[model samples]
Target: MSEHHELILTCPKGLESLLAEEAGGLGLEDVREHTAAIVGHAALEVAYRMCLWSRLANRVLLVIGRFPVTDAESLYAQVHAVDWREHLEVAGTLAVEFSGRGSGIDNTHFGALKVKDAIVDRLRDAGGLRPGIDKLNPDLRVHLRLDRGQAVLSLDLSGHSLHQRGYRLQQGVAPLKENLAAAILLRAGWPRIAAEGGALADPMCGVGTFLVEAGMMAADMAPNLRREHWGFSGWLGHVPALWNRLLAEAQERAAIGLARPPLWLRGYEADPRLVQPARNNIERAGLSSWVRVYQGELATFEPHPDRNQRGLVICNPPYGERLGDEASLLYLYQHLGERLRQVCLGWEAGVFTGAPELGKRMGLRSHKQYAFWNGALPCKLLLFKVDAGQFVTGERQPVARDTGQATPARLSEGGQMFANRLRKNLKQLSKWSVREGVGCYRLYDADMPEYALAIDIYQDWVHVQEYAAPRTIDPAKAQTRLLDALAAIPLALEVMPEKVVVKRRERQSGKRQYERQGSEGHFLEVREGGARLLVNLTDYLDTGLFLDHRPMRRRIQREASGKRFLNLFCYTATVTVHAALGGARQTTSVDLSKTYLDWARRNLALNGYSERQSLVQADVMEWLEKDSGEYDLIFIDPPTFSNSKRMEGVFDVQRDHVRLIDLAMARLAAGGTLYFSNNFRRFALDCRLLERYTAEEISAATIDEDFRRNERIHRTWRLQAGKTR
Candidate 1:
């Protein structure tokens, strides 16, 4: 073995520059950056230092050999050419991690197996004893990268990826990896801020990744100081004396750092469930005194008054990826910008998000932007100075006078009519809502042709969905009417401007209707017919709970005592919850979307429903085909047109209702009733099927007072399995 070995430190893609800077800071020689790895030459002591301190590197590998190979036989021969006894003992375990492709080795698993065979065969030939394979905790980890006809093999000095600092035991969805988090901090210039005695905060922190990493950097603590396992611990060339010396030095430095006053490191999460995990992670990292996590909303987040120094407010907010709604997310981004401009006037900001367009909605010009990859999703790290002058002011102006009284904005004839109609509708619905005990219902549904919008009130929140204007209408006129309606909503409805969410609703086909409209995962509890449901004002095109279903839910509660209930295409299972609360014997809800199924489970749990209620994530049609159990009552309300990739086939409610109804009738107990509904306006039932089973049209009966003006909102039918009436 050479006294100085060439090392390759692999990291996530787009982080090569940070890794190179870190390697150079460590005083390594010939540091060079590649696509996703850094190459450098250093002695054994330097490699040990890197293993203990390099937070941006995923793995630190020591290059042992390189050769040219064309086929699997050549690969085996080249691998066998190395003496395995020098790296691992015959009694030890080994693991091979093969990456890259080409040169007759296309499958990574096959390549790894061949490499393993070569090493075991060489060891057996030398001493007639072969090492066992341990994938989880290997004594020696061999890495092979094959490109073109070249093969490079290295010994992984870090047993696991360096990102696994052994601090995180729990994380929220789509968590930022530790290495990536470190890279973000480096880009945010946290070291400079720390030197100036400034604080760090992540308003939307998930499990405190940023806070922990920032605390470690500020305190000058080694990243892997708490780790107990390393690849070199069991290797043949293990240097116990050198490792012990490095460990002692790190411990002394950490002790000295811990003796000093703690830095201001804080995190705020909206979800209460995530706050405890962050606290646990911080405590485990020995940063409890420095890092503090609180359950807080973004609207109320502010810098601590005790920390008077200017610092950094960095966050990785939801990117509205799976949640396709961008309109609602714009409001959140705008609010973030407002908060930064108002509260963090002198601070710096870094927002890492996959949606740069949404970042633009912040209304603040980013001075610097860096492109990075968040697990194959290209994202940008937007840096802002957070100066008041940088904020684009006058973006919003008061539509009313400063007299502190409600006054309508002066508008054109069309806009005035729109505004007047909105106020009139609010007056009418306020009385009805109070009498009906409805906290969420539609107030206005495009009452006038010029003003095309659907305004729904969820208690204090107002949701306005603007219908896309026809081509005959001028776009400018439509936009003006929309602005007028937005201005009138908050005043007429007596709600805060921030509580109003607006989305444009167009004629959607296929799966477009189900796509997300935003990433604001804000859920509010609303009451409907003695059942409490969780409805998200932002995020999806439709709220989790359908307002029009209030009547149907009440009907189910009225008829569901001691009856077995089944709900197909059960979105959020609101009806099932009502049935269960109505004392149903058992309730089963089926849907294809895991997102909705999880939501349904939460809704059930919110209402204190027990395990007697079941939620299944499956295509409703497929499940119907396989189900044999009979139910006393069933509810089926499917989308008008759905081509979800998760479904077995395209479903058009008009085309498939007959087949779907027949399938449901097969499982419908004798004398049981089946409620079938669809929102397709032009749908017409097959009269021939009515000859076999008794049927009645309940569309008019199901229309609530809020939707009485528009009876075509949804059509419902009640069918019985006995005989024709």
Candidate 2:
């Protein structure tokens, strides 16, 4: 067991060549690289050296035996042929792990059981107490790799994964694994930088993994010097004096490395909550004198290198992993790129991200990109030399900041509080939204009285309406709070800040609500209830679709199949789109404005509706009087009041609803349904309608969970031909 042993050093994929190079430098000969591991011939001391210093390895395995096997019996027989007494004591604990699935063993657990039974039986035959089972902290860990009718068994020389450098007992969300960090640093050429006395910094150093790793590399400290437990500590073939001599040399080298003046190493994390944890990690790594952690943001991240000094800027920015969160993360990547270009000029940079497309959005041309896997996620490491030529300072497209299911790195106190409320709403509504196939919905509606903002999510965009503050409240304070809410919208919703379109909403008496707010004229398509419609978030005060009317649109969709449908006061004709998609026989929509009628034309075309649908441009009250069309299904959602030039007089919902209902019901065929709704908070239903038509109050049912907080947003009723009495 002593002359020369076969060693397999396992690392993550993409690190095989690096592991082979490092293993060769550490007294290993005839090294051959494989997919995720490297095999070489080395003495037991060389294997011990790798376990102590090879930062990129997951496990340092000593190959004990290899044999041919085609079945469980052969596997057990081969494992039993090994002299277990040479490795594990009879009183010691052991665990077995089997990888690959072939040779009549489909389950890894079952294969491991067979191996364990063989080892136990052989140890028991040798007399003394048989080894007990220990999965965690086992004195010996046995691994078998099953390939095409062949089994290669080995003993794990590293107890826990070598990445568990004993420093990061706690970590930030999505922390980059430590060994991967070291490999990244190596690829970024940090070893040479350290040799030249160069510095290193990570702006988004979560739990200080990168900073601690750099500190150790710069100080020549073995990555596992402080690790107390090891797989070879209790192994029967262990040599104590040889191990101590190597350990003494590593200690002497570490002292000389640390005795020099420390490099200018710094880390800045945006999350204040992570600052202490990061500092604690640096302290645990015994490099607190050389490394420091600070609470700072990417916007203000400036590595305090001395004048005429340059260093590497490294970060692992968030790659959003939720539905709308990726759009928001673009800003984060752009922000990182901007900081690198603006401040760290003439320095090198490396950014690791799971989203390569977002990395491309950074507006920096990377000289090189390395692919790596974070668990099952494929990621890229973008390498940049932060020079003026590499920086693309062209006018950047406006990027917004939206958070994902995971919390964003930073938020203001007020923003955090408001974001918490928004997160609660999103968590509550996400399941229903996904189940109901809703891509757009009202996310917030002034749930907190101070922030009188109604927020809606249109896929990845956020639409915010700041309800005009009342005279009783301080206008300045109200505006400040509104700004806070607006700022919080993008962060909470995981949307780009520019994607948040905000407008002030007050009592619009006439066509003021329909007036254009901006000339951006750009439209975004949103999906709901199987229909897709265009919403002008910037141009119009209201997004082309009303979120509160979602349930009502769904109701029309379910009942409109094979029925003649009519929509009155159809501003953008969104309801007509739903009806047409729901299989309506024919649809007729009436509105006064030519602009809205043109918009209705586009809405009809968007849903592939042409011949069977008609759009009328006359004023609705005037058109209804002359129309002779009969509709089996009808819907009327009138504004609170209208003062348009097309109308003869000011039309108010409370004052003119009875006359309006009479006109709409005249167009309803026998045994037809007329759904009438209005947003007039103070309007009262007339007792006269109860006698003229059968009325069923559907105000409660039409309002969904999102609008339940403020049911006064609208009221509705289903009217037929008969009266209640």
Per-model TM values vs. the true structure: 0.68, 0.62
Candidate 2 achieves a global lDDT of 0.85
lDDT of 1 by residue, 191-217 (tens): 999988888889999899999999999
Candidate 2 per-residue C-alpha lDDT over 105-180 given as tens digits, one digit per residue, 9 for 90 to 100: 9999999999999999999844456999989888899999998988899999998899998998788988888999
Alpha-carbon error at 90 in model 1, in Å?
1.6
Relative to the true structure, how large is the alpha-carbon lDDT of every model?
A: 0.85, 0.85
- Judge candidate 2 at residue 364 and give its lDDT: 76
What is the Cα-based lDDT of residue 262 in candidate 2?
Answer: 100
Error of 2 at 3 (Å): 1.0
Scored against the true structure, residue 406 in model 1 reaches a CA lDDT of: 21
Candidate 2 stretches greater than 4 Å from native = 125-128, 394-673, 676-725
Candidate 2 RMSD to the real structure:
18.3
